[model samples]
Target chain A: MNILMAVLLLGGLALAAGIVLAVASRVFHVEGDPMMERIDAVLPQTQCGQCGYPGCKPYATAVASGEADVNKCVPGGERAMLAIADLMGVPPKEVEEEAAPPMLAYIREDECIGCTLCIKACPVDAIIGAPKQYHTVVESHCTGCTLCVEPCPVDCIDMLSKPEVLEEWTWSAPGKASLVKLEGDSDARVA
Target chain B: MPGLLERLGGLFGGGVDLRSLISPGGFPGGVHPAQMKITAASPIVQSPLPPQLILPLKQHIGQICIPIVEVGDHVLRGQKVARSQGYVSAPVHAPTSGTVLAIEEHAVPHPSGMGRQCMIIEPDGLDEADQSMPSLCDYLDEDPAIIRERIRLSGIVGLGGAVFPTFIKMLRDQRHPIETVILNGVECEPFLTCDHRVMLEHGDSVVRGLNVIMHAVAAKGGIIAIEDNKPDAVDAMREAIARAGFEANIEVRVLPTRYPQGGEKQLIQAVTGRQVPAGKLPLHIGVICQNVGTAKAIHDAVCMGKPLTERVVTISGDAVPHPANICARIGTPMPFLLAQCGLRDLSGVRLIHGGPMMGERLPRMNVPMVKSTNGILAMRAESLYSENAQEEPCIRCGHCVEVCPVGLVPNELAWHCRNDQFDRGQEYDLFDCIECGCCSYVCPSHIPLVHYFRYAKGQVAHIEKERAFAELSKARSEARDNRLAREQAERAARRSKVRKSGAAEAAADASDDTEAGTSGAESGEKAS
Candidate 1:
């Protein structure tokens, strides 16, 4: 009779604990596409479709849904991949190849075949031209997506690397000046 | 005035015993370094003009100033040489009467090491002040807006190394009225005594400037904060407060000599006992903090109608033969000022702008001094900036945690930074760190904790910039897609209308043919 009473009491306690846990979860629960938003924010958002997805948002969705690999965003290089991996709570994997420096699409103006195919393909609306006139790209707005380069019928469009300029120069990370090192070196301690 | 009554309440004249309320209160971890104020004995001496002045257009912290004077144009002393671009910027004035020789890129005294637009002027040495300057008005009797305008026109900025335009700060929100104004006199940095000297010599001007600031903000009261270490500074300031008869409007608060006690947020907390929320200004807490030098500049601007051409700068170090405080002109080259102090050998000397603690090491000595320069120190190789600062692994001493004024886990932030986990560092409120170098000073491991924090901050800023660019691109892409869809829809609608009109015309032609056949048949029957 004592054993029966103890079992009943333990069952009641478990049920109460379960109800409390369920209520706590409901009270503390978050709403909205927080995971997708987080993943998308980490993306470079070039909308280049180089990752085999349509754009950065679509790829972010794919990564959140576990449909695409995190290492696929080549334009973002190692930085974006690491950031996404961090958000996903997964160990980062090495990419086979790092993305090269960003390149802007340059159209050879004299080629004379402005079929406007490149304009339609440009996701950023950086290209401006009539159906038959010469086309030009707004350099600032161009994402170096290469979408315009592929659709050019006359093969006149080419991607060029950005030129180095002083205005765009930024301060090197402060770590570059510090004595901190990943490897242990002699003469390291100074107090 | 209520401002006077409040000041009286803060003093012992009222019921509140302010001595009990006065304590060294601030944020989290911090370190108390040696005051090293040996140069406090030197009185303010006017620094002689240099042969050529290199005035960088980007003086105050904002958009670059637009050069109004062309090459070969003669500029008088205190004449506006450059126009301020926007409300956030301050106009740059000619330090002395000179001819604009060239406006080219010259090495500015910035840590970035990149040269910006600098106006090279050859001084004629007449030191001719502008004769047609604006008329001075009693700042107290004038409208607050007029006072702010006069302050802005004088090109006065926070001389506490922040270089933020003073006028912009004075324009507080009406919803949150400024209740208190604190002039930061706590020169907490080691090897810097310019502020201490400024108070001792120009106490009346500093108090009047505080009054003008209070008038501009319509604040109830003001406090001139000084370090307890500098007893002379406190006595001089108190005397000045009494002389100005502003004993009721302003009070003297002596803070314990601690590193970063002069920090805006730290000083605010020390004086008001209120913590300014992260990412919010002191104005949010009904407070406005100005530098002691800035207060003096405001008094000069409003009373004499003079522009901010010169300021009291502390020139001292072991490498210097004669270390003294000198009233130096803006845009004066570092070499000239260093020579006045009888600078020693330059080869092993590490020249730093501002105090030795937070001062930036000069890439080269020729960089021109701007409005925010408080002190210049030339340290011997083995002295202030120790070359043998051997960075060792963190021993997890919690010394940084104890000394941090912002109450941050600096070692953990440094760890995140070391491993390139800036996101995690940000989660720990990395930006909240003021980079006061206190953690590194107290660290037993000599880990250069501030360096890692700075690196982490820079990385976070770079990532944020990239993210902002990406957001802009995405918005553009979405807008472009919407435009294309709208245009496509319009074209489809137009095409359907054209098709419908053609169908109607064909149906009419068919009816006409049937009518013609019936008419022909009827005519044929009648003929028969």
Candidate 2:
């Protein structure tokens, strides 16, 4: 009789917990969009498939499905990658490289007949000025696609490397591996 | 007393002995060095302003502010000289009424000895003041967000050496419930007593500022954690807390005098006995920690309607004629400051920022003191060690291990870093290192472990960035390939569809012709 009572008590407690869990699940359930459009919105609309998919949208779909890695986008770099990775429930991978030297488009302001071909070729509209006017590359907006450079009749546009600022400067990591001597060697080699 | 029962009672009832208070703060690690507080306490003296102020555009940790005033523009003391770019940054005000000399890159207070965009202000010596201020009473009825904005506009930052913009830190998300606010009065570095004097002299304001922070975070209580070495500071704070009627909510916790106890994680552990996990902030553990100096700055900005323009700097070293804590205006040159302290010839002197243990060694004394400069240390040539000290191999003395506050095996990390085995160093949790210099300080071999770690972290960051770029390029290539394949497939399908329709049309025409031929044959038969 005692054993039966103990079993019945355990069973009843389990049944009560199960019911409570069911109720809680129904009450607190959140409806999430299957598309995860918000996560895709933060991505650089550059359609320059840096994220291992055919386009930004396909990569977004893959990310939402947990099939692709978030750190695949280089144009977005660390900051963008972090936001996407956080949304996708993944730890941010180490930034693949210190942001590649910021690439800027330099227009030889003097070099030419102001043909607006480069301006028309720019996808992001980084190039400014109307036809027959001096076209300049808004350094901030120029993605350095070289599409504009090729279109320039006078070859005025050049992809210039960003000037090294103090903030942008990082310490060179000590090359310790190179200091080690070859196996069965006598002296340490500084390569 | 009954023996066995009494012992058991003592074990249970004697709720955690007073000695448990000596147990260190929450985090795994910290560093300790020789305390050099005596340099300043000898006497409190004033330092005169420099002839020229080279204020860097990017003094704090965030975006550099654009110079609102151009060259030759006349500016007054406390004038709004530069405007902040974003919420994470702070505005820079004119240190003293001066003429803008140049807005160009100049040598900044950094280890790399690199140049940064600096605003050179030639002080006219008029000391003209800007008396413009918002109504003080308005703050009493102002929104918390408005108060925060005022603090940011004031250019206040963590004067505890981190120089993080205080306003940004104060803006906490309400979603994360803050349980406790830890006020860091630990002033744990050796020879740095600026915070100590601030607490002793301005205890009321500090407490008021802490109250404001508590209100901002809606924290249940606040703790003022100070090392027991500063009993006078503790007493002063205690009196102020009682006077403010915050005795119930705010308590003064006297921590054991240990090096680096002023560190955020260590102090958190020593006070709360709750370890902030690796790679997490104290806020994550339901606590928000602010330096005593930062809290005082907040009070000044919110209550006094003042921007962070001046700070108390401890000028002390063996070589100085007189060492004292002086209220220095930001952008004061080190040479001029030293001269004010009666140091004439600096030909063979070594100047360091902050305390000698963790402070960076200045390449030259010409660098101006920015918001983060807490202490200026000058030592005679004989007393200073060469930058490149002869490094000896590790003798396995375990001194570095003993002094490490984070409980990391520094020797292992250093070994991996030295061997260029970054992966191995990472495996030993190299990122967890705070680079506090305790291991380097205790090392008999003078291995410069902190430098090795910095180098390794930089390398890792670079490699990681390169890998990301490569991955991006690969992804782009793959995407192009996929698009081409899809387009080709679509073109093939369209071509096949067109061919099928053309065959059907051809079959219909042939059937019509056959029908016509049959009709013609029938007509001919009738004629015959």
Best by lDDT: 1
Task: Kindly list the per-residue Cα lDDT of model 2 for residues B292-321, writing each as its tens digit.
Answer: 888888887778766777888888889888
Each candidate: what lDDT?
Answer: 0.81, 0.75
The candidates' DockQ values read 0.20, 0.08
Candidate 1's DockQ is: 0.20
- Any runs in candidate 2 off by more than 4 Å, and if so which? A1-107, A112-162, A173-191, B1-32, B40-44, B126-128, B135-142, B380-382, B385-388, B468-528
Candidate 1 docking class: incorrect
Q: State candidate 2's DockQ.
A: 0.08
Q: State the lDDT of candidate 1 residue by residue for A1-191, as single tens digits.
A: 99999999999999999999999989988885678889988788789998989988889889998888889998899988888998988889886677878789988889948788898898888898987899998898888989988777789998999864434544454436532211112221110
TM-score of 1: 0.79
Q: Write the residue-wise lDDT of candidate 2 on A1-191 in tens digits.
A: 99999999999999999999999989988786455565666565454444656555677778888887778776667766877877877888875744455577888888846888887566556678876778898875655555677778889888888666666455544333322211112221111
Residue B108, model 1: Cα distance from true site in angstroms? 1.3
